[model samples]
Target: MAVQWVLVCHGLVTLLVVVSFLCGQWPIFQGTFIERIHFFLTSGAYDYFLRFVGAVFGSKCSNAVLSVEYYCCDRPNPILQIFYLGILSMTYYFIVKSSFAYIPGYYLSGIHRYTSLLAVAVGILLFLLTSFSDPGTINSANVSQYLSAYPYDNIIYAEKECSTCKIQKPARSKHCSICDRCVARFDHHCGWMNNCIGERNTRYFMAFLLWHFLLCLYGTVAIGLVLAGRLKELRVVYILTVYYGIENSFLGLAPHVAQWLLGSYNTLILIAVFLAIVGMLLAGFFGYHAKLCLTNTTTNETFKWQEYMSWQRKLNEAKASAAALRASISGMSSDRKPLLSKWRAFFQRSPLQDGQIVQNNVYDKGFVHNVVEVIYPLSSRPSFTRPKLKPT
Candidate 1:
């Protein structure tokens, strides 16, 4: 019973940490403990650690830690890439060590041993493709091509030059300070891949996300089948029903079966739980990126649009306030009239109600076109080099 409780608690904590880390900043989670946990996991914990180091050691040691952090986070370093590989290898190693002997058991086929390796290899290939591929870097020679491909919308994107690169910046291109280069159709830089996700390699990055999700799902289901096989081979369920006199019905037998599995295969349960949580997270992340691709938007564009909408809303409110004041003054200066009834005043619409702001995304060329654009970036097409001809 104690062991079962411990496993339950461990699963709950893992789920909570994963959820908080991934979604603490979301509007739905705002002002919740999940948000606080997210803050601690992402930044607060590191801050406290740094303070502890500074207090315990000297300033020189603290400076070294800060320098390591700067290189790992603010600059283009392979720390996360190496970390990702390490985790992947270690997880596979554990799975093989704990579960491989039962691979050809009753519920699972022998072929899974090879298939699992292939799946992981494919996932790593996708990762390498995303990590090493050019993310549509805009350089001096091809700047004209990029400019022709993406015209300035004059709203979020305006006709401007990149001060750092000294080149005309195309629409949707952003200068990545970490990479120290301008990327066309820029998405956020992924620390895991240690590369910017941009026009050229967005497809690869998306594939990496989707494939890894499937891989985790595969592991979870495979491990579950292995555990189920163990139960069958050991006759644990039948023995419980026969010798222990437990009821055969699911509700009656569930607790006993659970306790048996918890006692016998706790490691497998942990691995399955971990994989399930990670799979769900990857699925959600992939869904979000898929939505962005369908809508012809980037993570950076989302922030830009939010800022634009906020500014527009504030401007509209200011104008409404001025209009209301002017109307009040004009009414006061005019010949006196009967004041409106309280009921009439109560039902009257406020001028500020007109302050609703809508986002206008010119680059969203419709669903199919948007998806195609991501799959085959405009700059990759030959027609991208051709500038629009002026009217005769």
Candidate 2:
């Protein structure tokens, strides 16, 4: 079970690292854990024993206060942040879902797409919340007054680390221990996303989420449609369906979200079709991004590699990129390093390997819902075949 150990270790480490980065409470988790070892060094029980022993030696008593922000992302009210984390805990439930056969056109087996669809709804929420127009539209006088003070439409800076750095919060800044650098507009750094979700790529991230959720949902329905079509030939109940049922299948669709937006019959069908198509496209996107989020897919992955090509290699490709780059230079490189050297390094890493499969795999089993699933490359890949879900 070396493979299992490796997977478990990777999962624990990655999850802890992510949780640490997101929660900023490594000390707490670390300390609270392995308490027996820490007792002699930091625990009160050990201190009492030491003081008792030192009573004969006349050890002096001292008092100090230390406050720790544990598990709550070091925000002003971390307890609230934990509560929010509970709400935002993403599940691959949509993807793990069973098919409902009673419905004529219902879909199944494309959890990856359902995840994309779910992410889209989330992206819209995040984008909209992030979308206020500087509040300058309402007051020109305040805007003009502020122009001399700050003088930029959208300006964000990384506040330098210092004793007072805690108070001098910078715009879109997060202290990343893994990178050991502060990222701007710090969203979560996913092992899946492989990079920090900062100011530069938050939009893409949200978009990825939106696309991923829809993709999973679409594939779910589409797979169901195909499965339904095949099952019709046999005319068997497909016993699993009797329990999973048609009503619960509605969970795959953002029933509330769709209903709120689409009121017309023709419009609803159109919306449904559009959602379905988007979901299909999302399936493709998730197939791509599952490698991405779990492994280090980047913007360069788009337009350059089908998989996770390192930014360095992508940079090198860019230097030689007369043929590789887009019509317009988006200047999307994560590293501002020289492109030629980056290209050389990329070639060195993989001489014949064309695309990448960057980042590590995390196979944590406790809870995974609506997770975008990828088919491991195998001897055979038949598209129309009904698939089996991988064990958690």
lDDT per model vs. reference: 0.93, 0.39
Compared to the true structure, candidate 2 yields what TM-score?
Answer: 0.24
**Off by more than 4 A, model 1:** 341-349, 385-392
On lDDT, the candidate that comes out on top is: 1
TM-score of each: 0.95, 0.24
Candidate 2 minimal-lDDT segment of 10 residues: 370-379
Candidate 1 global CA lDDT score: 0.93
lDDT of candidate 2 over 216-254, digit per residue (tens): 465445544544454444443343245435332446434
